[model samples]
Target: MVPMMMLAAIMSPSAQAQPAAATIESRAREVVALLGGTGDYDATFAPSFRTAVPRARFDAIAAQLQQALGKPTGVAAIEATGPWAAQIRIAYDGGTLNADLTLDPGGSHQIIGLLAKGAEPRGPAAQTLDAVVEQLAAQNGTSVFALARLGDGSPRLEKARNATTPIAIGSAFKLVILAELVRSIEAGERKWSDVVTLDGSALPGGGYAQQPKGTQIALRELAERMISVSDNSATDILLFHLGRAKVEAMLPVVGFTDGGVRNVPFLGALEVFKLKGVDGGALGTRYLAMDAKARRAFLDGPVRDTPIAAIPRDLFQNGKPLRIVELEWFASPNDLIRAMDWLRRHMDGTAGAELRAILSKNPGLPDATKHWRYVGYKGGSEPGVLTMTFLLQAGNGAWYALTAGINDPARDVDTLKFTGLMNRALDLAAPR
Candidate 1:
């Protein structure tokens, strides 16, 4: 956590000086051009040089660009090009435009260049992006996760954990449900005030949220519970309303291939079964025969498989036994960043306000703020699986994407201890 003294020092009035108009204009134009637009450039130049630009700002910028560009653009695909420079690209009406910008120590900055069409990057920025990806892949994990930051339209750090391999997102998959709920509300399919009842049977064992019997809650309140509290009952209820088929069908539209929620809420164990008797009857046969060996195979496999039993055949499986049903909630580091990008784009509108309301209600903030700086996150845990991902908007506009998952075959691993370690990793990953 940034010390209170430091926070005060950074927030002090003297530290708050607007950059020269030329510099601000340059940066603004660069940001607009990178976003493929030049309209309504509203930005706040923080007084404290030490103050990181709020993640909310980046989200706002992304949202504006999406509105201008009329489609989803690569807002999170930004990376640092130098100690103080970055690059990004935005898809425009008929083509793509790339912009590179640089920030000076005094917050004075310039939009170095804006290409009419997207250009293939070369030189230092590209090299830096490649290097970051390699470094993330080398982390002590079996899965692949990468994060990139673009300044002035140049790639800085595109690091990956395993890069090529995919892992189960576990409870992080709830984000998909959250996104769907938001979409439904926006489409008039549902309303925030629509009351949904939660029954005891909907609860997942060992998960957070006590099963409140016959509890009546608004759909929006349930969405908040699903995300802020990681409530299994809320998620199950939302999933039922959204319909497994509708949710599964939406993944491809968002550039996800390997994520989808199973009809069953807690299918962690059932995911490994290639074939299981629906009733677990006499004709039943476990796909891998042994859970231990099956888990080993899953961990070792280059591409993880989602069991048909976990996701129903009619909803997800297209007939093949090993047909993968990637849950929208399961995000790679890139996926998390993408989701954050999406959230950032919608943050300025009703959707953004709703998300902010939900985020403010998250329980992790009070405790997590103790050691971390600018932590906006959603985490989920269950036996054998622990997942947490965040879009850590740094004290500078610099942002870091952190997702940590541990599929511990040994159920003895301490969750609190693991969360602490993950926090440490996040600290290390944050800009000094």
Candidate 2:
């Protein structure tokens, strides 16, 4: 789980531009072939890698893995970092292992680095919170985790790791959006059935964005989609309706105390898409330099008119996760716990019930629902960010909140592996 750094021999800085799709594909094929003992080491690995781990040693290692994990299968996935490096998922008969793969940044595109890491641990690893934190801290650029029991007052921390440090939470910030909408409803300022129009910006699956621009939909449905599927278009509409200033204010009230200064003039989902999509992400490079005022001006001025079609066809595929750590939503695992507690405490009337339904619609971790009387979950991810938060009511009606987030900022973190770790954390925090 350590933050991956390329071997010093080719420690070249990555261009913000994306790596070519063909390069990723070819490198993946070569690595798998090499693992299977069918490809030549000299051809598959660069001289730097071969020099550090000799051809004989690499062959022996590959043989050892085959003995332990069975045959080397195809590359399951590749998460590219900028224009040079990628984290590759290699499938095997028993399970999977990850490879930190890098190509020479020089025009040659030679395989400059290759380091194979162990497959994810089974249920045997991380028996305690301290153990879990060790694993988490080792795995990402910054990892924040919090587990708390909720009561009438503040949440009680059972275990926490850098719980107050802000890290990008990706779409998990939709929780705040949901929170703000619920708060407004409780204050009689809004209603679940209130209608809003769609702007039809594209989202990853067909969202309201695919519908006609003039089409109207209920706020409840929008919130449901935003949380249940992490629907970006739906989130943008709600953010627009609520206004950024209002959502920004809701941050600390829910849990994130520094949201205003950290994320001034808040951003919508489409706005982020545009920022990362235009001019090969040159706009983001410029946008990153500004203060709150300048950023607001830039986003509103030229950035506003950036076309929807301007978003890359491979927006998430082979794309560098540009400026996500700085440009996206920021929250701590502690903040998420308090946010979940706030939503739990709000459940006294219709607004409360609606909030529960929206948050519970997905359960993010569906199998765990059997362990609690009630389970409401919302999670989020991008290329290099993964965050999950859960609100649970135990069989004894005791309430608890569990959250974990990993921000790599270099390559994508493995979703299955992180979820496995969080699953263990939940079992420890609230055993069946």
TM-score for each candidate, following the candidate numbering: 0.48, 0.71
Error of 2 at 228 (Å): 0.6
Candidate 1 lDDT by residue in tens digits, 1-432 = 010011011222333333333343445444544344333233423332212223343444444335434543334344343443444444444323344433443433322222121222222221243444443334333434455453333223455564333455556766666776767776777777888766644233212235466877787777776776455556767776677556655554343444323322223223223233233321123333335446345423411233233433232112111212222124455555555555544456656677757754542422344444455677654334455666556666665555655444333123333443454455456565
Among all candidates shown, the one with the greatest lDDT: 2
lDDT of each: 0.45, 0.74
Model 1: number of clashes? Answer: 43
Kindly report which residue stretches of model 2 are placed more than 4 angstroms away from their true locations once superposed: 1-92, 95-125, 199-206, 258-260
User: Which consecutive 10 residues in model 1 have the weakest lDDT in total?
Assistant: 1-10
| Candidate 2 lowest-lDDT run of ten | 1-10
Candidate 2 collision pairs: 1-138, 1-139
Best by TM-score: 2
Q: What's model 1's lDDT at 21?
A: 31
> lDDT score of model 2?
0.74
